[model samples]
Target: MYRLKQMNTLRNQIFLGFMLVMLIVLGCVGFFTYGQVSVLLRNNAEKHIQQTAVQAAGKLDVLLRQVDTFTAQVATSATIQRLMAQEAEGEKTTFAERQSMLQEIRKHEAYTTGIRSLELYTTDYRMLFPLTDVSLNSRVPQEWINEADAGMGRLVWLGLDPRNPDVVIAIRNVRLIDHSFSYAGYLMVQVEKNYFEFSVEGESADNGSGEMMGLFDGAGKLVTSDFPEGADVEGMLHSGAKTIELNGSTYMPIQKRSEATGWRIIILTPVNYAAEGISVLRTVVVVSVIIGGGLFLVMTFILSTMITRPILNLIKVMRGAKLGTLKPISVPSSAMEINELNNTYNQMVDSLNELIEVVYQKEIVQSRTELKALQAQINPHFLFNTLEAFYWALEEKGEEELAEIVVAMSGLFRYVIAKTDGDEWVTVGDELDHAERYLKIMDMRMVDRLSWSIEADEECRGAPVPKLLVQPLVENAILHGVEQRLGRGTVLLRATPSDRPGYTRIEVTDNGPGMDDEKLLALRCSLEKGLNSRSEGGNGVGLANVQKRLMLYVPGGEGLTVHSSEGQGTTVSFEIPNAHKGEVES
Candidate 1:
């Protein structure tokens, strides 16, 4: 199995595919060439052996015909016939006459060099001359005698001589050339085994090493063979010319039959003799393939690297960009497509950087402008209303309480206007103090009709809260809820730790003529909908501005909430996150 992380690279895949194809092509060519060369070598060897056998068979046939012609000449001689006729009549013959006849017969004995010995026998199986202790009738096998008698003056092969197993002989019935064609006796010509050997003497001289040659008679009997030890003679005789393996050696057998002699000639040549050149060719092909494969691998490696190097470089740059390093990439490459891709990436990065800078500057300027506008709106309305009330108290009431109201009003303005460096949050204590100051001024204006109280938990006093967030709600409660009533009303402000962690709850309540469900619903909807200072109502921009500030500064959307009932009190509350923990002294 192949893995993506291992050989899944495009370069590796292409290299592997190329190598596979080369191997297949080389393997196919090598196999085909080897097979063809083997076949050619084998066929050449077969043809050579077959031609040699044909030549040997032709020579053997000529030798046998010469022997037969010599035998016929001896059989038709008049001198031998007169002697045989005289012997058949049982006539006494003188020693001198017998010696002359013997001399005449000896003249024909040297007719052929292939004949080892020649003998004549009478019809009664008696040798006429050149007598030996062995009788012709007793020495000859019955089968040979039967074949000689059946020949009726024709030459006949008698196979191997019974008296001398290594000798082969031809026999014929000798007859007188008379009107009756009377049989005189039998003439036998015996030849040594070397006579047959001379027939195939130079025929197998060119045969290669580990070659075996054999001759078999018509009945499939082994007449002679030059096969080495461990040769399977019986197996060879049973089978035709084909390849065989024996004793760990491979052989190709060639067999040919002679039409003249009814003899089979077989040759077994080792296969390796013909395969020697093929082995050398195989070695050359293998070496060439290996060297070519090595060169191909090296070239492929270089080419693949050339293709993938630029891609890897681009990937490295992309990784840097992923880590927030938006910088231009300048990878140089020979390929036009890669160069164009890098240029496009650089352009995109430049555009993005410019866009980020423009957006950041615009946001900073807008935030400052909005904060300044809010400040301007709060300063004029709050200071003017408080100063007018203070002036009225000084003119109409005594200066005893007016001085206190002026003092509180001065402290409230000082707290609001005193800017802290880079600090957007104020403590809950400071916010409650600002609200108390505003209530004090309003108390003086309402006199007996307005009563107000401010309460805050010590734990919540130090809670950091948005500036001017609570004071506006208290002013609205007094002016709208309590001041509108016919009877004296009470205004209350409270700040305490809320049930939610990391937050403080601030509520402003007024006991006066509370609104109906419709008015309360409308106010609640306006708070939830996120009021802005541009909004106009009985509460003017104060309530909306506080809600907007809370929404912007707080973590969640818990800005402001209002609850009221007819003939009951009205309460407005909101929660501030991170406003419950500070440097508060217990």
Candidate 2:
């Protein structure tokens, strides 16, 4: 009963853990995917709305241009110009002349199809075209007259007519075209407000629910709108192409500015309609998560039973063996492998006592042999040469200097061969110490020509880095920079905190003849491409190897960097993220 309870507890814990992890992963993925998809849909809707507005604006511009063209045609006619010139001469009014002038004005208005009304006014405010209407002779608005006169010949929008609020009027100044273009009169053209409505209706026909469009003048007053309740005129004027909330619903509004009339064409669509696909996706994700979770629970329960049954049976046999009963045992299982394992365990009880001593002795001998084999892999010639050099140094130099060199060499070898917890990393302080040892060996070789210094920040010493990360870079500096120089040179190694957080920067610099631009560019290209070996006449193989290792082991460390100019020194540097700081210290 206790074992059964333990098995159920284990199964429940494992199932819960797996479910928790799956829920987190799926939730994050669904959230970000939904956000991205929603953004894409909104952007596409905005583009479509903007395109529609642009087309509508284009049509409106064409219509306005046509109005201006027709007004110019009538204003510049010879029949109107001759009568205007005659009227300007202050001749006693002749009925035939007045009738001829009125006939000319009517003839021009008849040719223009969309014009609701055309009225010709002399500069003195005498109405010409609608001579029969007594109200037409009323005093003309001074604002319209002044704007028309100021236009100089161009058409000017006089806004909606106050007397007939449904009409939008444009006016042009009439002038005689002899030598001096004298102001003769003004010509006004009126268009019904419904004309603008018809112009934009074709684009809005296919738009779905909560879709609306509006034409607003430059001052943001609505001239026409398709929606019965209209839009938030103030909000539409202040906002650009974006999504907003209106009347307890989300809306996406797009505005296109027309250069001809200084008007704005706005199209508003509901956000729900625009993101229809996202709604379906959200539903699918919810349903899939629910179904997937249920199936995972059922599968987990079955697998747990299969696994724990064999394990429990093995435990029972182990308990029996522990109680000193060395007899054959049997436990039935549905799995063939588990049954075979049970049979093997029963057979092992009979011979375990007999083979214990033999197995212990064999393991002891095997461990020793393996240790000796690993030690044998070290090159004997290199060790002999190192010893011979140590002997020669002892004979030539005194004990103190030779002893220092020997110690540095020993330290370098120890660092190279040391193993730590199966990880290929060390502290920055240890790596620097290894680099210093290498430089010390080289210093003895060059004696007077090579001088070096290693400067590292106290805080950075404990930062974790890959083993032997800096030694190769220092070696490269000595080989490529110091060896190629004529006079004495200095190599500097510096470790500091990097610009990015949780990273350290290590730089190796040499005060020797530097590379030219072409060579520098080629070397950088090779390093960036992760070229393993240096090209012919190239001197960056060691640096490349170090860069590749750093990139492999360090998460955010971008390989190495080299900066050099002709006749100046070179600086090679790289960064290491300070991961596993505690591990390195321990």
Best by TM-score: 2
Q: Least lDDT summed over 10 consecutive residues: which range in candidate 1?
A: 577-586
Please provide, for model 1 over 1-586, each residue's C-alpha lDDT reduced to its tens digit, 9 standing for 90 to 100.
Answer: 5575766877787677777887788778877887888788767766766776677667667777887888888778777777777777776445665566567766776666757777877787777654543556786877778878887888886666766868877888888876366887888888766676633435445553566667766656666677666677658546764578767788777677767556777766677875557778778778877887788778877887777778777787678668777888677878898898999989999999999999999999999999998788777568757776786778576785776787777777777676656456788988888888888888888889888888898988888887778888887887778877898999889988889887788999998789999988887777777655332245444777888777677645577878889989899899876533333222
TM-score on alpha carbons, each prediction: 0.47, 0.48
Q: How far off is model 1, as Cα RMSD?
A: 31.1
Give the RMSD in angstroms, all C-alphas superposed, for model 2: 10.6
RMSD (Å) of each candidate, 1 decimal? 31.1, 10.6
What's the residue-level lDDT of 482 in candidate 1? 83
> Largest lDDT belongs to which candidate?
2
Candidate 1 residue spans exceeding 4 A from truth: 1-4, 83-101, 122-142, 145-154, 175-185, 199-210, 229-235, 239-250, 306-586
- What tens-digit string does per-residue lDDT give for candidate 2 at 1-586? 9997865665577677777877777778777887888788767866776677778788888878888888888878887787777777775345676677666767776766668877777767676655553332264477667767788978887667767868887878788897288887777788888878734446545565456777877657677777548457556446563566667777777677878677777777777777767788788777777887787778877876766667766776568667665777787778888888888887797688668878999999999999997787576546646766885787676677777788788777767765557557778999899999888898999989999999999999998888877887888888878888998889999999999898899999998789999989988988888777542346444667877776677645578889998888899998887775333221
